[model samples]
Target: MPRSFDEILDQAAVPDTVTDADLDALKQEIVRDVTATLMFGARPAPEGRYPTTLDRAEAALTALCAELIHSTDAAEHLARIADLPIDADGALHFGCLLNLAQEPDGALWWWQFAAGAGNATAAYCLYLYHLFHGELRDADHWAHEALSLDTDIHLTSPAPCRRRKLDSPPEVLREAIERLKVDEVAGAQFHHPDHRLADQIEELADAC
Candidate 1:
C-alpha cells in the first residue's frame, strides 16, 4: 500500500550533518519540483522533463508541509511560500490549496488572496473560472492580467479537475481575433459599448 502523507513525513530522515541552509534549500527544491511536475508537467532543468508519479508528488507536498510545521524560521518560510512581490511559482503553490478543499468557494478565496499578492497564475485561473461561469467582463480583465506576465504560458490543473477547459494560452485566442478585417469585426463581439476595443470578450466564453 502507498504510505499516507504523515507516514511519508515520518519516514523522511535528515542527517545531523545536514546544515539548516541545506535543509531549507532542499525544501525549496522539492516544492519547486512538485509544483512544476504536477501542475505544468515541466521538469526543472538539469533534470529530465517528465511528469512526476502521483505517489511521489503527494510525498513531496506532504514533506514540504512537514518542513513548514517544523521550520525554526517560520517567518522566512512563510515569506518564501506566499509569493511575495509576485513570484509565479509561489502563487501556483497557494493555488494547490484549492484542490484540497471540499468546495470551490474556499479555493477561490485562496486563489483571490494569491492573485491579490500579484500571482499571475492565480489571476489566470480566476480568469478561467470566470469564463467558465460566463462572466465575460471579469474573465476578460483577468485574462489580460495573466497574459501580461507571460504570453506563451498555458495553465492546467495539476490533477483531473472541473472547469478545466481553458487549454490554449489566452494570447493565442486574442491573436486569432486580431486578424479580422475592419468591417467583419464589428458589433458586441468586437466592441463592448461599456468599453471600446474590448474585441471578442463576449463571444469567447461561449465559443470556447
Candidate 2:
C-alpha cells in the first residue's frame, strides 16, 4: 500500500539523534545549499533517484496531494490550491516547491510573503537561505525573529499530522546557530567579526 503522506514523512523525519554531520550530509544530498532540506515537502525522497530531489518537485507534490485532497493527483491539487486564498502554509510550501524546481527567486518571494504574515518557519527558511549565501548578519536577524515567534511550527504540507511532526523551530535553529555563535570565541570564521553586527542588522531589518 502507498503510505499516506504523514506515514511517509514519519519515516523520513530527522530523529533527535541526528547529528550535525548527519544534517550536513543530508543537506548536501537533498538539495543545494541555497535552500533547507528540513523545510516542508523536502523529505521522503523516492526510492532510487540518484540526487534524491524530486524532479520539479513532482513526487513531493504527489505525496502532499494524497493528504491534501485525499487523492494523489498533482495537477488536480495544484489547480485547487491555486484557486483558494493562500495562507502561511500555502506560501511556505509554494516557495519550497519553487526552490525545488530551481526557481529560487520565486521561492524567496513567496517565503517573504509568508514571513511577513508572522510565519516562524518562513523566517527560519530565510535564515537558512541567508546563511547558505554567507549573509550571516541577515541570518542572525531571521534566527532571532523566528525564536520570538510561535514555537510550535509545522511544514506547509501533508496537513501537519502528529505522525509527522517537525522538530520545534527553536530546537533546530538553536542547534544551527550554536556552532556559528561567535560570542564565546574571539574569532569565528563564518560569523561576522563585529559583535555589534546583530544590532545593526536589527535596525536594518526594521526599515525593510
Candidate 3:
C-alpha cells in the first residue's frame, strides 16, 4: 500500500542531526518541488499524482528549519527564502520567516509580502495583527480579502482542518501571532468567520 501523508512527512522530515549544508539542500529541493507543483499543476510520477502528502512534506521541512536554524543564520536563511518565487505567494518562504526568524518585525514584513501576493492565510494573519493592535479598519479590510478568497471560511483552527469556531477571538489572535514560537509552524493555517464587518468598518473609516 502507498505510504500515508503523515508517514511520508515523518520519513522526509529534517533530521535533528541535519547540518547547515543539509538544511540548505533540503530547502532548495522544497523550493524546486513546490515551484514545479505550482507551475505544472500535476506531474505524473511512477507512484501517482501530486497530493497532500507532498505539501505536508514541505511543511515538515520548513518546521524543522524552525527548530534547527541558528540565530546567526537567520539573515542568510531569510535572504535565500526571499529568492523563492511567489507563485505560491511565497508560502514556504513566509512560513519559515514567521516560524523561525527571531525578529518579529521582519516576520511581519514577510507576512505583508505574502499577503500582498494574495495569500489568504497571510491576509487573515495580517487581519488579526491589525486587529490586536487596534487598527480595526485595516483589519476589517484584510478580513474581507480573506473571506473573498474562501467565502465559507471558518477562522479558528491552527491548521487547515475541519471547519469550527472553537477558538475565541483572543485565542485565535494569539495562536496566529504565536506561530513564531520556535519550531512550531507545521500545521498553521487560518480562516475567517462570515461577517460584513469589513464594509461597515470601511464606511466608518471613510467618515473619519
Candidate 4:
C-alpha cells in the first residue's frame, strides 16, 4: 500500500545532515521528483487529460520544499529552482525561492506570473505581498484569488506541522516577512473562522 500523505510529509520533514554532498543529492532528488511528476501529467497533454495523481504528486513535492528547505542552504536551493523552467504553474517553486532570497519584487513578479497561470501558491504569495505592503485592495483581490484557486486549502492553515527551522538569520528573517503577510491577510479576512485562532501567525507577522 502507498504511504499516506501525512506519512510522506513527515518523511520529507526529516532534517538532512548538512553537507555539500547531501545538499547536492537532495537537490537532485527534488528536481527529479518535480520533473517526473510534471512529465507524467504531460503524457496525455495533447488530449488535455487531467492527471490528478501527477498534480497531487507535484503539490506534495512543493509542500515538501516549503517545509524543508531552510537557511543553511536556502540561497543555493533558490538558485537551483530559479534555473528551472517556469512552463507551468510550478513557477511557485521559483517564487518560493525569491521569497527565501528576500527579493520581494522578484518574488512578486514570479508569483503574479504563476497566479495568472492559475497557481494557488503563487496567488497566495501575491496576496501576502500586497497585504504586507499595505496594498489592501490588491491584497484582498489576490487573497480571494488564492482561495478561489486553492480548493484544497493546503497551505492556508498555520499548523505546527508546517513549521520548520532555517539555518541562517537572513533566511529566517525573510521567511518571517512572508509569514507576516500570510497572517495579515488571514486576519483581515472574515471568511476563515480559524483565522482568529492564528495567534502565532499574527505574532510572527508583527515581528517583521
Candidate 5:
C-alpha cells in the first residue's frame, strides 16, 4: 500500500480496473513502447535525422505494385511499404525494423530502394550492413554513396534493437508508420495541389 498521499496520487488512486499488478505492467509497457518508438519510429541515426502515421493501407497498396529484388521471407513486409512518399525515408526506417526481425535480406532491399531515391542515411545503413556481413567491397561503395549524399540531410533515422523487444516493436511501429504515411499524404495534398498523390502512386505502380 502507498504510505503517502502523494504516492497514491501519483499512482492514480488504483481504480477497480487498475489491479495491483497493473502498475508494474504499465511500467513495463511504457518501456516497451518507448523502445519501439526509438527502434522503429523516427529518431536519429548516428549521423543525425529525426521522424509519422495513417495512409498505411494506401502505402501498402503502393508497395504491392512494386517488386522485391531481394529479401528471403519479407516480401510481405516489403509489399507493405515502398517508395515511401518522403523520398523513401519510410523505407530507411522500415529497413531497420526488418533488421530487428532478423530479415537482413529485407533490410537490404529497402535500403537499396531508399538509396536509389538518394537517401544518404540509407546509404550509410547499406555501408554498415555490408561491413557487418564482411562484404567490404559493397561496404566501400556504400560509404562513398553516403559521403556523396551528405548534403541531403533527412529528417528520419534508424536505431539498433534487441531480440526480447521485438514482440511489441512491430505492432506498435506499424501504427506509427501508418500515421506517418497519412501525414505525408496530407502534406503532399496541401503543398502540391496539382500533383494528386494517388495518381502519382498509380504512375509509380505502372513504372514498376
Candidate 6:
C-alpha cells in the first residue's frame, strides 16, 4: 500500500498548522534549513579545509530522496523531486545541488520540471535561475507563479506581497542586483542562443 504522488501533493497542500501564516513560516524554515545545510555545509571545522559538511549535506539529501521514493508512485514526482526532466531523471538529491551543478543546462532542466509540478520552492528557485541567467520573461513569469502559489497556500490573505516588503533589506537587494547582472552575463555566455530576453531580465532584476 504505497501512497500516490497526488495523495502526497494533496496532503502537502493542506496547512498542518492552525493558520496559513504559520504554514508558510514552516515551509520557509524548512527551505532555509535545507538550503543552509546543503549550500554552506556544516560549520566549525578545521581552518584549512572542510568537506565533511558537504558530505553530510549529501547524506541528508539522499535521505530526502529515499523518503520521496518510498512515499510516492508517480514517476513525475520522482523526477521533480530529483530536479530533472520528465524523462532525464538526473541524480540530484538536494535543491542546492542545482547551484553546484557543472552544467546549467542540467540544472535548468530539473528546475523547470519541479516548477511545473507545483513545488513552490522549486518555482522560487526557477525564478532565481531566470533572474541570474538574464531571462527576464521567464523570471517574471516564474516569480508571478511562485507568488500565486504562495497566495493559494495561504487562502485567506495575500502573503507574498507582505513577505516581499518585509524581507527587502538593503544588503539583500544589492546582492539580488549583483546576481541579476551575473545571471545575465552567464546566460549570454552559456545560453547565447536564448539570450534575446537578457536585457528584459536585467531590467526586472534591477527593479527587484
Best model per lDDT: 4
Model 5 alpha-carbon miss at residue 185, Å: 28
Off by over 4 Å in 2: 1-81, 155-208
Off by over 4 Å in 4: 1-84, 159-208
Question: Per-residue alpha-carbon lDDT of model 6 for 22-138, expressed as tens digits?
Answer: 889889756644554454353424425753333333333323333332332323333343343342222222222323322345446555655676655556556655544434467
Tens-digit lDDT track of model 4 for 107-180: 56656767887777677666556544434468668878978887653363332232333444254445443443
Query: Which candidate achieves the best TM-score against the true structure?
Result: 4
Candidate 1 lDDT by residue in tens digits, 46-151: 5256423433333333333223223344333234543342444433443332222222453355456667766676676667566444344676687788777666
Residue pairs with clashing backbones, model 1: none
Off by over 4 Å in 3: 1-83, 87-96, 99-102, 152-208
Residue 7 C-alpha lDDT in model 2: 95
- Model 6 TM-score (2 dp): 0.30
Question: Of the pair 2 and 6, which is ahead by lDDT?
Answer: 2
Number of backbone-clashing residue pairs for each candidate, in the order shown: 0, 0, 1, 2, 8, 3
Q: Which ten residues in a row have the lowest lDDT in candidate 6?
A: 154-163
Between candidates 2 and 6, name the one with more favorable TM-score.
Answer: 2
lDDT of 1 at 139: 61
Once fitted onto the true fold, the runs of candidate 5 whose alpha carbons sit more than 4 angstroms away are 1-87, 151-208
**Which pairs clash (backbone N, Cα, C closer than 3 Å) in model 3?**
155-191
Name the lDDT of candidate 3: 0.45
Q: What is the C-alpha RMSD of each candidate to the true structure, in Å?
A: 21.5, 21.2, 21.5, 20.7, 17.2, 22.1
Writing each residue's lDDT as its tens digit, candidate 3 over 1-208 gives 9999999999998888878999999897566545545543543233355324334333333333333222344343334443543433344234433333233354455566666776676666666555434344576687789777666532443343322222232333334334423332434333221122121222312221
Cα-based lDDT for every prediction = 0.44, 0.47, 0.45, 0.48, 0.46, 0.41
Lowest lDDT 10-mer window, candidate 1?
188-197
